[model samples]
Target: MSIAAVRIIGIDPGSRHTGYGVIESERGRARMIAAGRISTASGTVPQRLLQIQRELAALLHEFTPAEAAIEEVFVNRNVQTALVLGQARGVALCALAQSGLDVAEYAPTQVKLALTGSGRAEKLQVQHMVKVLLNLQGAMAVDASDALAIALTHAQVRGMKARTDALAGGKRWGRA
Candidate 1:
């Protein structure tokens, strides 16, 4: 028997801590591959940026995801916080581009709505839902589960669209 191979990586970018999860999509099934965080504590600004870049590059190399999805930067009341997040996001994008992985992004509201069916859902609810969907063995931290939820959202939506198209007898991309 032959195997189908497809992989996706999802990232939640932050200056102090970036969260990521890897999932493989094969024969229309999405499976969790790995997850981790990249963080910098008490360092010079440039040094921290360099560290983030290095960590992201390492993650890309290891996962070798065919596609990458990142949570878009949101506007914060604190300008400095927003800038820091944007900086991290920039590095994440650069890493994916350098790795030649296709990148897509979803806003915070979009991710929340997609995962929990409501933008105002509590963090715990999203985390709990993600745990159930992936059949994770143990409870996951908020940031990590959030990253996984984002990936699961993409998988769920993509699968739904594919099924809908099939029922409607329309062709979609990626079908051989």
Candidate 2:
């Protein structure tokens, strides 16, 4: 059976810079569509949140992705910094929901593991894997590469689930 391509957008939310990447995935292959960061460096907390929302909304409209994925906010040493990051993540979630797309969240370790063999992979290792998996060249921002890694994680996960379901004779297995 031929598997249809799925367009997915992945987001790595931050207070000052929110990274986003779009990709088209079919079977085990994935192709990059677009990737960039939304900067909100010169604004207050609320203003930065609003900027993230508006820019994310525009990107959603432009990409028209079938699904979305976001990296979960990791615990930070500074509570205040974690709170701000959470706010940015909330804005990103709202934008994805408003676009009427199913949003999936993956932990940072999970994303790294999906891209690299080890969950403890370094940032540079993950970035290198992202470029290798997508056959991409040229300079890419670290944030942008991280976003693409998140997208690729979703693609890999969904593809595995599909195959598992197929093997199970189209029956729902494990957790609902």
Candidate 3:
């Protein structure tokens, strides 16, 4: 028996550039549909947020993904940068919600670990793994690759959950 493919959209939110990737996954196999970045470099904060929203909305409508995933904000020493990132994330969440997508949030470490088996893996390592996993040749934007990683992580997690649920006769221990 063959499992149905689940289409997913992943977002890597940033103030200047928000990356998005779309994929269809069935069982443990994933095929890339599209990947790109929404650039808002020459706009004010509000304008940038608006741009992100509009572009994401368009992408969602175009792909009609059944699920969505986004990278959670990782705060570092720079407070202002984190705040801006949060804003971008908020916009992304809103867009996903409006599109009626079930959004899943994953941390940077989770994404890296899912793709490279090491939470502390470097960006290049993650990118290389993304290319390998999707069987793609040639270069891609770093942000777009990160978004693909996020989608792949969600796909892996969902696959595990589905197997566990099947093994347990579709019983849940607690709230999911």
Candidate 4:
């Protein structure tokens, strides 16, 4: 018998509405556990960041995930929005660090490509693929789906890395 693998929590950080998702993988399979967004009422930027940090900490404790995958903020057409997203991501990192969980980052293009087989696929297409792959039925908010997609992408990359390392006879991280 083998020990069970742990789950991962994925976060899509936004100052106004930070999205989060939990996923588990074992024997080369990935599944979504939960996904949601946390939004703070109108407040100052620092206050909003603090609220996001507190919420992230609570979520980490509740989920008890082994690791975290966070979507990296890319240069966007909207500078202000990007800045706010950066702040939210910082808060998320802080929470993960406090909990002593490892954090990984992925880009949007990478996430889209991993989930939909095409980086340029439309948002609806990505969402549909997520629902189909996860076997989730009926309506799901786009933000929730996006968060799940991010988690899945990280899972795929991590799986590929494991295979490559095995072929090259490399040791797995954090495994003795």
Highest-TM-score candidate: 2
lDDT of each: 0.79, 0.94, 0.94, 0.83
Which structure is stronger by TM-score: 2 or 4? Answer: 2
TM-score for each predicted model, relative to the true structure: 0.86, 0.97, 0.97, 0.89
Pairs that collide in candidate 4 are none
Off by over 4 Å in 3: 173-176
User: For candidate 3, lDDT tens digit of each residue in 1-176?
Assistant: 24579999999999998999999999899999999899998978999999999999999999999999999999999999999999999999999999888899999999999999999999999999999999999989999999999999999998888877677777754546
User: Candidate 4, 103: how far from true, in Å?
Assistant: 1.2
Model 4: per-residue Cα lDDT over 26-75, one tens digit each: 76677888888888768999999999998888888998989788888977
Q: All candidates: CA RMSD in angstroms?
A: 3.4, 1.2, 1.4, 2.9
Residue 79 displacement (Å), model 3: 0.4
Off by over 4 Å in 1: 1-5, 26-29, 164-176
Give lDDT tens digits, candidate 2, residues 54-160. Answer: 99999999999999999999997999999999999999999999989999999999999899988899999999999999999989988899999999999999998
Clashing pairs in 2: none
Write the number of the candidate with greater lDDT, choosing between 1 and 2.
Answer: 2
Minimum summed lDDT over a 10-residue window in model 3 is located at 167-176
Give model 1's TM-score versus the native structure: 0.86
Tell me the deviation in Å of residue 6 in model 4: 3.0
